[model samples]
Target: MTEAVFRETTADPRTQSVPLSHLSLELGHLYMEDFAAGPERLRRHFDEVRIWVEAARASAARRTGGKRPRISTCFLIDDYFTRFSTPAELVPLILKEAEEAGLVIDYLARESGCAVADRIELAESVMHRLVESPPPGSHGSRPPVSRTGWLANGQRTPTTRNALAEVTVWQPPQETAARNHSVFMDVELWSEKDGRRQWSCPFLAAVWQLARLGLLRHLGEPVLTPRPWDGEDFPHDWDRLPPLLRLNDSATPFSAYRTCTLVPNRFVAVEDAVRLILDQTDVDSGALRQVAERSAGEGAAVPAAVAQRATYVFYEEPIDSSLSEGT
Candidate 1:
């Protein structure tokens, strides 16, 4: 009799299920510039965002057929590009402003977390999953030539040397989804300096959106799980705290079927780049199926396309011009 072989299970991966909410709403985003302008600036930003938050909640409820919808609110603080203040100093100011604005932030995350959280390189993993959309007349004879550190909607004009050694005429880039004329956009995803890579703001923002949608995983484990914050004072240093902090224990789940982000109109370009990146990324199949199955069971199915599940509301810049600029 021949001996039988047994298969090992280390290769198989499974995503841990997170409590699903009907919507995850981003209340506001803070950058170094916003913090430098002082607490007054933050209060103004949240005051404007609060109005949109209510609108988003109403829209989510309507989407769920007017039933009580589970919604979670989150805010992102910019600690990656430049650290302005310590968490002990900044977190309280943020909470105070939000409270004054009649808004509550259930979850707070650091911008750096999108690049790496819990020793996992979420941005790098997402970069590996990018599958560029092929332009028309593609016959599969050759793979799309994607430029390193950049993503574009369609093929870019080539720069080749002719037999006469003369430069070719410049051709305008085109968008694959344009109806008549092309408004092409080429987004930079990262840059290298001194043998280290810096992830772009839009790239990290895209990762943040994916995390909110519950589509991110590292070897089948959820990335950026919110750590509950006790009543004790926040750490003096920023790095002492976890990437994500759950401030409200009674708040709904952070991950949800859909997400609505309220940001300044100046971020329209960045958000557009984010959509381009998200449209190309192929998330975990098991996680995707799980969300689909669960959402359908609740009688509110989500969109098949990952990009379609995200919505954004771009508001006018606040009175403070200094806060308008920056990530």
Candidate 2:
């Protein structure tokens, strides 16, 4: 396997200004690039990146616990690739990399290292693991234990399965409301099976597709928030979404859903554009009042401050009463 190389940069002289999350995000982008390239590429990148990250972590652990920290890592391969020979390969890759990172940090710590230096180093390592590991287990769970076999000493036991979900919002390109790859596309996807492509299905199919893609591999049910554009009629009228938009696997905001037009255009940097639009708004999102009336049940209440700025500009009329009921 080709090895990954993570060359260390000059230590930031100013440490207080950096956000670890931001660093993780930077690494996340780099990891995404490797993922898009190929598994061999990802493996090589992970090997190199894991060493650099662990070196940092080891430095930190020295200052904090005079010990090394081990990151337990795993990867979920896209299900469509299961039949292929390489589908099971990522499991060991993650395990090996995690072990290597932990070892590197130990070596770094034992060498001449200052607390500040160690902290910076360790922070980098943790961020590397964060980026290397898929987003925290946001998707649901593993499949069942086989059809139906349950018992505690011959007594039937209940078998449970967790639901997986996410919210993927879209942003549109400045010029038009058309779906384009330049403006959008997942940041990265593995190209196994000789560049085999995956198709996305709508509604339940969409959810199933996400599960198959390893995108919905969260270990728990997600806590969904209404999109800024979600109004009483939003869920009901979701069918009006473009065919591509209809393939959403989460409770993504209408604006975000519509942003898929940009995906095809390669404008996946929707966050940058959204930030720009938010800059133009005088309305304070944090202090907006609740505009919609309350629905019955023990659902979480929408904070008035947040609700005030919320708008339903894109939703169509409710077509399904079941959907409108908001289960």
Candidate 3:
């Protein structure tokens, strides 16, 4: 009798290989507050970001041993939290201001894409992959402690249920990696409203970072693939545009070995929380190994830890009186 042949094609998933660049540089990010401040605000933002763009390119070149690096620049718009204007009216202004500032934005993306892109629940998949960093004295006996819809750098103070319980002193939060003192930060991943889950900004930003690093996949296929834009007019509605759009035909690939984001100082806290989330996320082992192998083969080895591969520049906020007030 012939030997039996069996195969499970779906069991082994494969991630599609994307063209890699030495660095994926983020020129800037715009939120509803910035947009409300008007076109002048955007012009000021690009002017400040242009200096850092050059610096980031130089840094990437040094990391590649002075080799000409394939770098891509992208911008993110806040269409998730609040939709201020239509893409048709807003995109052209952004491109024009960026060009005037002597900068080119190769790709444009919407913040909502991180939550869901092309019918894929990207944030939910990322949540499932989170493997928290176990605290000291963690034995295999207890399940990993996690606050639902929240991530913290260290253990939090226990909650007391009984109203008659003895009053306990407030305990200061601690950072897991703190040396002498703790600078703890607890980030909210999501919130439930009317049975619908709303992802937080920091959480979405973490997903964005993973995408740029080529570490996100839905059933082994890359998520949030950039759809080419033919330089025609943008759709009147934001939803009509793909989650990620490639604006420049000659630009390098969106995903790369490393990423650098430049934003205003106001986003420093949010970005820090993004790092905390990224540091603990356990990405697909196959995808992780593929990136490591390919990057090393090109003589540009990336950081062993995913969080370390990202860099950020927090520049001064534009001098606008309206920006000083909360939106």
Candidate 4:
């Protein structure tokens, strides 16, 4: 029998004519967290949204032969966290619920200002402010306790900043000693110091609190239960992830031709949500097949074809609190 012939085509040109976005899926979003997290967090999220938009814009541009396209994005979030009684407790609950639901939270670097801070000094300054002041109008008191020399600066007041950022203080039902209901705070910022190389301490503490309290883990499950992580799923199972090629459609009209598809393998379970990012390449298929054929007899496996980037979508219902309703 004659050798199989393969035909390859480059990225689709139509992508330039359409709009694309990298779907910012908010699985279990806490609204109070959004408002209480302060402008820096909000700004970070906004910046992240723009980055995805720009990436898609670049992809569309290339598909249409350098036609830069106007790309728009839809932010999808599952407002499941609203059911939790305490807004402050929502984060862990949301994370756990997401884990059980098999959803992956892509902590896009663009969404968090903390992700941008590279130095401990920057982290400490930002965290100090977050923990002390919070956002505006959220807390009833001022920055509670200031240990660092940062307060020496006259620019910020402890009380005013505390009042603005405090979202809520929860009092739990189980009472012990003088404490009755646990007081929950809405937004909290934490940072690492220069001497201590532990920038992740804050995040870890938050996660541990959630995990220990069984907030994210099911209430019935042991508090020590491990939360689901991205590495647990497919593609991640492979010893190595294929090199990622980020392409942008630089043209305005936009086309669907530039994209890549993520295939599942022994290491990872192919996820439907991730499939939206594939792009069609302009390389010749015959050339690709010939290469594959040449490599096969020598023990190389025939490589699977690559798909273009596809669009991802996520949606979350808005919180209905009296505070948020007005917003």
Q: Residue 310: error of model 2 in Å?
A: 21
lDDT of 1 by residue, 153-251 (tens): 976664446658686757566688887888788889998899999999999999999999999988888898899999799988878879999999999
Model 4 spans > 4 angstroms off:
1-32, 48-52, 83-308, 311-327
Q: lDDT of each model, Cα atoms only?
A: 0.88, 0.23, 0.88, 0.28
lDDT of 4 at 272: 25
TM-score of each: 0.92, 0.21, 0.91, 0.21
Tens-digit lDDT track of model 3 for 58-159: 999998889999999999999999998899999998999999999999999999999999999999999988887655644544344243787878756544
Sliding window of 10 residues with minimal summed lDDT for model 1: 138-147
lDDT string for model 4 (129-177, tens) is 2223233333444344233322111113232234676755442222111
Which runs in model 2 stand beyond 4 Å of their true positions? 1-43, 51-74, 81-83, 86-90, 101-327
Question: What lDDT would candidate 1 get against the real structure?
Answer: 0.88
Q: What C-alpha lDDT, on a 0 to 100 scale, does residue 127 get in candidate 4?
A: 34
Give the per-residue lDDT of model 2 (tens digit) for 211-312: 111112111211111112222222222123111211122321211100011011122233333322222222211112111121111122223332122111
Candidate 1 vs candidate 2: the TM-score winner is: 1
Model 1: number of backbone collisions? 0
RMSD of each: 3.7, 27.2, 3.4, 22.9
Error of 1 at 73 (Å): 0.3
lDDT of 1 at 305: 92
Cα displacement (Å) at residue 14, model 3: 2.1
Model 3 lDDT-worst window of ten: 138-147
Model 3 segments more than 4 A misplaced = 1-5, 137-147, 159-165, 321-327
